[model samples]
Target: MRAADRFSFNHATAKFWDQREAVEACARAGVGIGLWREPVQEMGLEASAKLVQDAGVAVTSLCRGGFFTDPTPAAIDDNRRAIDEAAALGAPALVLVSGGIPAGGTIDGAREGVQEALSVLAPYAGERGVTLAIEPLHPMFASDRCVVTTIGEALDLAAPFPAEQVGVVVDTYHIWWDPQVWQGIARAGREGRIASFQFADWVTPLPAGVLTGRGQLGDGCIDFKRYLAEVDAAGFTGPIEVELFNDALWARPGAEVLAETKAAFERVVS
Candidate 1:
């Protein structure tokens, strides 16, 4: 299939889309979907799994399972549940957001905590055939959202485990600004560590809190074509999920946003 043929709509792109409807839309488009935890739980895990299975919708990746900056027993248990959910949903990867610096803790300490948590969970995830995809959020999110902010750093964390057990998320919005991004992607490919590939353009004048300001494809300065080319060259033949966390898009109807997003994706990638 062509790279665009592997397009998967990330549920976060249309934050409010009904889960069943989103699966139907993806089915209609003949594409896959990247799901999130909350909606999956809301619909009941078995029901959600059934929804996607019955629709014949591929589950690209699950939106998150790691917040082990503190590495509490409860936190690790929750992540284990996430892994089980991913396996049940037939998702090959579980996106992990290695949470921010803990309160009264240093960034270094947080990083250490993430490693510790992963060391414990990676084996568990591997046994269930789930890859813990470590997502490196943008630098701006480092202080409070994710301590892992670069592909290289994420890879280092993943290195301790087998690539099948631990890998990294190559989200354009998160890594576009890193000068070492291309190198990182290449390295990820060579190491067999690309667990997920996500797309989100970077726009200027980021909104307050800077969480919901992701740009639609081709609406900003990200060179998506270059990203595609680079990842393709690196042997990353996988679904490219478009995940935009945009306030404006969320304000509109989910169908409208999906239509627009599909058009934008075609325009940029075609």
Candidate 2:
């Protein structure tokens, strides 16, 4: 298939994009999409499901269902709801942004908490035919964002579960800084756990929150072809989701961003 055939626009890339508008754009372009929980819920569970179904857009994966480090029963319950939402949207994978360090907790402790969360939620997801995709954020966000910061760490977290039930998301912006990214991709492929592949460029002078500073494709130094070759060598053939969380992108119209994002993806991956 062509590189564009695998292109999926993650709605979070354009943070304020309307859910209906995003879905329609992806469908019109014959592209797949990754959705977030809030907007999906805002549209009402069944309504959102019908919207995607009617739009004929494929839901590549759900944006989140983690943060189990909170040690609250509500966390697992929310994940269960997320899994249900994914099922309703016919999404095969539910992305988990395993949250940051807990209060009075060490990194190791937080990791253990993630493992515990999975042990409870994995089987539930499995029963629902949804794979739990653990997305490792950049290490810079380790303290306040995701505790899982590398593909290797994500794979380690996925080790105890069946690959069919748990897998890792490989996004360039998050792992491009890691020296062992290729090794991790190989390992994920060997283990049959390469669940989701995404792209975003890393730029310096990160903004205050460090959340919305992602650079446009060609604006930053990420080596996209290298990542593509490595993952392909590792045997992953799946949707390539482009997720750019940037203030500039979010400020523009969603349709314009989608068009620009698709062009950037073609420039880099085609």
Candidate 3:
């Protein structure tokens, strides 16, 4: 199939976009969508689910559901709720961002928290038919955003669970710089653990905070074709969600941003 056929516009790319409009826009373009929980909740889960279902837009994967670095019962409960949401929306995967080091805690201790949390949540996700897709952020985000900084580490955390219950997200913006990324992707595929695939570009001279600095496709240095080729070769023939977190893009009109993103995706990966 063509790359466009697998394109999914992650809502966060246009952070301020109206959720209903975004879903309709994606539907008009015949593309899938990756939804975020806040907006989904705002729209009311049932309403949000009905919107996409009525629009005939596939809900590729839910944006996030993990922050289990501390693994409190509350954290586990929240993840279970997220799993229920994903299942309610007919989303196959719930992307997870292993939270940063907790205060007064070491990174090692935090990782153990993630493992513990997953052991409980993974089974719950499996029961709901949702895959817990662990996402490894760039090492730069290890302290505040995501502690899991490499595909390898994410895989290790997912090792103890069934691939159907727990998997990893292969997002280019985060893993492109890993020298061992190719091997990591291969291993994820071999183990049937590639549950979600995302695309974003890495630009130089990052923004002050770097949290909202992801570049649009082809705007920076990421080699879209290489990532596409590798993931495809690795056997992940699924939706390729472009999930840019750029401030500039977010400031524009949602429809305009979506169009630009779709065009850029085709230009770079097709």
- How far in Å is the alpha carbon of 52 misplaced in model 3? 0.9
* Deviating ranges (above 4 Å) for candidate 1: none
Q: What would the TM-scores of all predictions be?
A: 0.98, 0.97, 0.99
- Reference-based TM-score, model 1: 0.98
Q: Rank candidates by lDDT, best first.
A: 3, 1, 2
Please give the clash total of every predicted structure, in order.
0, 0, 0
Question: Model 1 over residues 2-112: C-alpha lDDT tens digits?
Answer: 766878899999899899999998898888999999999999999999999999999999988988999999999999999999999999999999999888999999999
- Model 3: lowest-lDDT 10 consecutive positions: 202-211
lDDT of 2 by residue, 73-175 (tens): 9999999999999999999899999999988889988888999999999999999999999999988888877999999999999999999899999989899
Which ranking of candidates, highest TM-score first?
3, 1, 2
RMSD of candidate 1 to true structure, Å: 0.8
Model 3 local distance difference test score: 0.93
